[model samples]
Target chain A: MTAALEFREIDVSFGGTFALHKVSVGVHEGGWLGVVGPNGAGKSTLLRTVAGAVRYGGSVLVDGEAIDGRSQRERARLVSYVPQRPVYPQGMAVFDYVLLGRTPYLGTLASESHEDIEDVWEALEALRLTDFAGRDVATLSGGETQRVSLARVLAQRAPIVVLDEATASLDVAAQHSVLELIDRLRAERGMTVISAIHDLTAAAQFCERIALIDDGRVVAEGTPGEVLTESLLGEVFEPSIRVIDVDGSTVIVSLRVEEDPS
Target chain B: MNAGRPSSTRLRWWWVGGAALVLAGSLVAGVMVGPIRIPPIEILGTLINKAPFVTIDTAISDRTEAILWEIRMPRVVLAVLVGSMLSAAGAGYQGVFRNPLADPYLLGAGAGAGLGATIAIAYGPATSGWFIDPLPLAAFVGAIGGVALAYLLGYTVRSGRTAVTLILAGVAVAAFLTAIQTFLQQRQSETLREVYGWILGSLNTAGWEEVELVAPYVLVCLFAIFIGRRLLDVLAVGDTEAGTLGVRPGRIRLVIVVFATLGTAAVVSVSGLIGFVGIIVPHTVRLLTSSSYRVVVPLSILLGGAFLVLADIVARVAMTPAEIPIGVVTAMIGAPFFAVILRTSKAVVS
Candidate 1:
């Protein structure tokens, strides 16, 4: 079978500046690929290019076919995307907002049916958000709101899910819970995930393979043991970091640099 | 999106029913409570008599018949049509632009129509009859012209048709057109009175021809808008979200803007730039119902018509003999009510 997702020489620019270089990556069916990069390193841009949220050069294909060739409905059914920072449609209640994921199934003139409505509730329940269904989206706490965003993507029921910094804003415990939940969901449902994460340790712990990006280029890509080495991360990140194994879980420890007077 | 979860489907139906009842009451009062007194039953009998098979012995007189058919009936119909068109278009504009403050008059249609009317009053024959209603015709052409200009300028300057750019372009175009209209008003004394009166807005000269001018466009636009209501909800989240939802936000915005502009131009061409109805009616509908366009669009039509008709009645009776402008009444009432709604409703602010 073909790889579930592929990016071959994807290049994206805004105005005159490049957001991503000629980047290429792919994930196997039902596999998780974590993307880690410093700020402005084009990690989010790579995911956005695959999501078709940004104009890009070259091909980003799903299941061996170019995505741009597909209709909006087809692409929506094939892949779901969650932006890092979502501006929730103000005044929309959580239930109704999540229910928008059923757009692919709905005819232009028709509202949601019983099945679609049931699926929205199911998504809300899965996210532990059933209680907040009637709440205005603007009033949600950061974690709850992020879960709601994830719930919307969940309701899409797509095979491939891409999240850009899905847990960046959560507390440490909340982040672990969200990562754990995503892992459990993927294991149970056989979902293929490509997440752009800011946390190197979490990416090392959760993802089977990690791609480290720098300045719009994929600088290092392999298993965490191979890619998350001190020398590679030290050069790319401002803070020197060490990656070590503790109880079979990967941990990244930051080292302070001596101050130098200019 | 889920029925009754947010919308309370059954209660929503009750809301619709309630609005229809209000509209019926308004229509009845609109006809019966005019300058000449007529009973409600006789008015109903006169309306029913138009049908081939149905005839009632409500003892309708020729004077009452003429008053109902010739005078009140046409004006009320025009009021409903104009009200429904403006309010529906307003809801559509708000959804497409994803802004609560958006109005039907946002795209320079008000200014364009006013300038068009001003020119006709100053230069065209002032005593023109319904057959050659030069003022409304000129207003229609001018409104279309203004919107077209704004769209072109917005498209060019913004580099893409961003909502903010379009609104900015509209503001600039409207201001420029308003300046020209003011200059023309100052140049001619006769033009001053006509332009000032038209600016205030009135239904004093409403007739079948005005109704005919507005009905076809409103019906078509309203049908088109209602069919595409779900797109509005999708678009509310912005273009990227809309695209992921299997919608082309750009195409949807263009379709909605065109349909709404056509309906708005049609009505404002005849109604002489009636203010506040478009903003207040749709705002009120969203305040009462869920913001889903499926509910808001239809309800706006009913409630907007009823609201405007009631306002017009106030305009008629508030200072009788010398009529208060319908636009003044709508603003005086709508502004305060809308302010109260805005201050109290946190949802609207969001």
Candidate 2:
């Protein structure tokens, strides 16, 4: 079967600066790909480009169909996106906010049906947020809000999901929970995930394949072991790091340098 | 089925009841305490007896009937309609921008209307029969023109068309128009006081004719906004997200802006720029209810109507023989409440 999403020679520019240049990537059905890069490395821009949020040169295909001419709603129905930080309007109940994912299903003047309500409940339950259904979204913690954002995409029921630094604001436990939730969704629903993650270890732990990006180009793409080498980390991340093999698995650790006062 | 959880239906009904009570109270209070001081019982009697033009054996004079039906009733109705339009427009603006601080006048509509009215008055009331009509046709035309200009600027110069940029452009446009209006008012001293008083807003001279003039536009705009309320909710989730849901945010925003500006211009021309009902009423409704435009839009209509009626009552009875401007009453009530809401709630503006 063809990959769920394919980006071929995509180039994206913002004002005078090129954010992404001639980047080619593919995500297979039920695959989990992790993108890791430093700040201003065009990580978010790449994902946004694939999602058709920004105007870009070149082509993106979902299920072997070109998506360049597709409307936002049509693209949305194919691929759901969970932004880095979700901002909720005040006094918006968590349930109502999540139910907004059903916008594509609603008629112009009509309200949500009972099925929509059930879907909202199921989404909240999947995220273990049933207790927060009536609570205001503004009262949620960073982790809870992140999970809620995920729930919104889950309710969209799209086959592909793009998570843009989705767990960056969460605590370690919450981050693990969020990743596990994504894994569960992928396994149960046969969905594909493309997460732009910052934590290299987390990326290695969760992603089936790792794509290392630098200055808008993909430097390496392979299994975590093949791509996350000591030299590669040093070159791409500009950090002193050691790669060790522990129990048939490679682990990367950064070494902090001591400051010299001369 | 969660225990003690209020179903959306029940909560909506509760809001409906609360809105109905407020409307009834405001209407009774509106007809009772004008300069004529008709008792609540007498007003009710007049309303019921006027079905087939019943001749009441009470001491209610012809001036009293004229005041109640011809003057106060239409004024109150106009206030309700204008209030509803402003609040609905404010809610629409807030939804479109995804910002709590957005008001109906964010598109330079008020200033443009003001400039239009100023220019018309400067040219003198005897300029044309169209000008002599109490509707402020020039102001309405200017408001629509201002929005059209803003849209043109947004389309031509801006690349991505951010909501923040639109709001900034609107503010700049308002300031520019207001400056021109002020200069023109300065040149024409005879109409300056009338123009100034109108800008501050009043409901003193409203009658059935003014109500008839503004009602159709308000109804049409309200219908359009109501139909598009769900679309507005989609918009609140950011433009890209809205697009993913198959909505063209740019096109939807244009439609909303045009319809909302029409409603706002129609009302503002008649009411002379009554403030805060647009900004405060919808916001207060949102605070009590949820941010879903489904609930906010309709509730805004009802609460907005009641709010203005109550404010008009206060404007009329506060000083009795000498009436304060309706805008003054709204500002006095709205500004302090707005401060309180901002201080107490964690609602982010953008």
Candidate 3:
């Protein structure tokens, strides 16, 4: 079977500085791939390039089709990305903001129809945000806002979902809820999930396969146990850590601490 | 969510319908009293008589007939056209820029129009002592040219033009043009009075020709913006998000700018640069409705027409025989009202 998303030799540079250096990876259909990397490892750039937000060299394929060649609208229909810091305009109602996810399906000259509203309502319901439908996003709590962001991507109904550190600022409870929701969606809907996660423990628990990136290159790519080894993480992150199995899933727990001298 | 009265589609229609009713009232009032106080009944009769196949017995005298049909009606129509055009463009600009303070003329239209009118006053047939003012024609061209220059400068920065860069480019262009205009005004001291009068803005010379000149452009541009108001809502989130959602922000913004500029230039050419109606009317609409452009655009048109019609009435009657410049009247009214809005609402950023 064709992989759901494939980045073959993806290279991105900014004014002679490389962001992603001939990086390549692929995920099978419906697989959840978590990207773990140190700062400046080009994890965010990889997702952004695949989302076609930035100019990139080499080929990115979504379900065996080149992503760069597709029109923006066509790509949006195939893939939806939730950015780390999405700007939500003040005074926008939750329902209205989520309805924007239906834009790819909408004509340029047309507004949201009843069917589009129905999809928005369903997405909100999935995220347990039905009660806050008419609330302005400005007044929302952090957890609610994160859930609302997820609800927007859920409303898009794209086959492949990419979360680029979208839950980094989220609290553990909110992060759990978001990851569990994505897990449920992948299981029930058979959709692909690719994420750039800072939480090694969360990535170990949630992701079936993990890709370790260091200095704009993928150092390892395999199942959580295969790739998220103590030596590999120690070498890449410079943190002494231990990987433990909590039931069937791997969990990364810090074994040592480097305290600030000050 | 302040839960400000359930901002659904039904409530939005109510706002539109309410504004339309107020606009009708203002239109009638605009026609009835202007230098000559024609009675309400006579005004109503004259309006009905002019309708197809319906000629009522002449309750209004012939002078009243000429005043109502030829003078006040055209002026009132132009007022509506200009008011609605500027306000819609203003609201559209605010949406594009994602800033409340963004006005219709923020993209060099006002300065360009003034420069154009000044050039005509200083260099055109005014030296021949002809009453045929070439200011309007020149103003229109200069307004479009100013915006074209801004667009070119903004476009060179990127294909997906960001609002901030475009706004900066516009301000730079407007400042340059204004400097030139001032120099021209100083050189032609004899024509300075008329140039100053034009800069202060007025609706004194409004007529059928002016109305005809502005109607098509304003109507077409307004229709396009109304159809694309949803994109404006998406745009408020920012361009990259808008693009990721599959709505090309640059393309939509360009379409809006083209039509809005055309309509605005037409009105500015006919009526000079009446201030505040564009900024005030749209900001008022946003306050009443949510910040959704879908609701703001149409309401801006309706309320803007009403606001300017009322402002023009004040311009004519405030001093009672000595008319003030309509722009002066708007600035006086709008400045205070804007301050009040700022004090009351937390939405105003600057």
Candidate 4:
């Protein structure tokens, strides 16, 4: 079967510096692919290419069609991206911000119809954000803001979802809850998800497949058991680490050496 | 469960209705409170008499009728046209840049018009032609040219945020044009009074001819901008996010700039360089009404018209016999109001 989303030899550069170097990956339909890497690992850049926010060489295919030649609006319908930092204009209401997701379906002069507003309300309700719909976006806590961002993507109603370290700023509980929400929603909607998650244990716990990247290149791509091995992680990441399976769930722990008392 | 919802659409219509009434009141006051102080009854009668298939016997004298028809009516209409044009354009600029302080003049349109008027006053045909005056034409051309130059230069920067680069380019272009205008004024010191009068701005010479000149451009441009107001709300989220949401930010910005520049150039050609209406009106709309462009753009248009007509009335009455420049009146009110907004606005970057 054709992959739901495919990145074939994607190369993105800013000026003379390369952000992504001939990167390639794919996610099957209704599957979750978690991308894990250190900072500046080209994860955001890769997601941005899928979002059509940046120009990239090579092709990104959605349902076997190359998206590179598609207009921004057309690409928007195929894939929705939740950026690491979502800009919330002061005084902008949460409802209004999320309604912007319907922009792809709107004509230039068209206002949001009843159905559009209904969709927005549904997204807000699903995210348990109906109470905060009228609140100023800037006034929201970080965790709430991330949920708001996800609500907006849900409102977008695209077939594919890409999130770039969306939960990086949240506390552990918030991160788990948010990811759990996304996991449930994705399954219910039968949507393809490619999320760049910093937490390896969370990635292992949630994602069916994991792709580990380092220095703009994918170092490992397989199931959690295949890619989350200590030898593979130790070579790519600093210090030492151990991957243990307890009750059929993977947990990763970093090994930090203590200084000797002289 | 729907908490804190502003209900922007319903609230917008309410403010729009209120602003329309204010505009009506301002128009009446603008015409009735001028130098001659025609009675409201006479003014109403004369206005009704002129409407299609309606002729009413009125107490208005021939002189009063002439003043109302030939002078005040045209002047008031021109004020509405110019005021709404500037404010709508200002809201457009502010939204596209995602900066509250951005004004219609931020793109050098005012500076370019000023320079053009200065050039026309300092060096022009000595004998007046029966047909056209060169000054307004020159000013119109200069305003569009200035914006074009700014856009071209801004396009070259390509790296950082385009909005910031465009504003910087406008600043550089405005400075260069103003310097040339200053040099021209100094070279022909005899024309200083005429140049200064024009720079200070006025609706003094407004007549049916001037009203006819700018109305179409203002109407068409305003319609285009109003239709695109929702896109401006999308733009408030910043360019990259807007792009992800299926809006081509550059395309929207260009459409707005072109229409706004065209409208502003038309109005400025006839009315000269009226400052502060652009910044003051839109910001006021945001402060009092909804911050969304859906509300701000339309409210700004109506309230901007009222604000300027009232300002023009003060210009005519504040220092009787020697009328103050309308621009001076706006600046006097606008500067302090601007300061107040700056202190109170939550959106300001610290």
Which candidate comes out best when scored by TM-score?
4
lDDT (10s digit) by residue, model 2, range B1-350: 64465433224778878987898788777877676677766676667777785665656677787778888889888888988899999999988888777888888998899999898778745745543563388889888877777766766664668777787778778888889999999999899888988888888888888899989999999998888887887787788767766678888888888899999999988888888887898777766666678788888988899999989988888888888999999999878877898678754443
Docking class of 3: medium
Best by lDDT: 4
lDDT of 3 by residue, B11-65 (tens): 3667878999999999999998777888888888988887999987865789888
Off by over 4 Å in 2: A258-262, B1-11, B39-42, B45-63, B125-135, B336-350
lDDT of 4 at A140: 94
Superposed model 1: Cα runs more than 4 Å off: A260-262, B1-11, B126-131, B342-347
**Best-performing candidate as measured by DockQ:** 1
* Candidate 4: pairs in clash: none
Please say which candidate is ahead in lDDT: 1 or 4: 4
What's the TM-score of each model vs. the native? 0.95, 0.93, 0.94, 0.96
Clashes of 3: 0
Model 3 error, position B7 (Å): 9.7
Ranking of models by TM-score:
4, 1, 3, 2
Assess the local accuracy of residue B268 in candidate 1 as a C-alpha lDDT between 0 and 100.
83
lDDT of 1 by residue, B163-202 (tens): 8898899999999999988888888777687788888888
TM-score of chain A of 3: 0.94
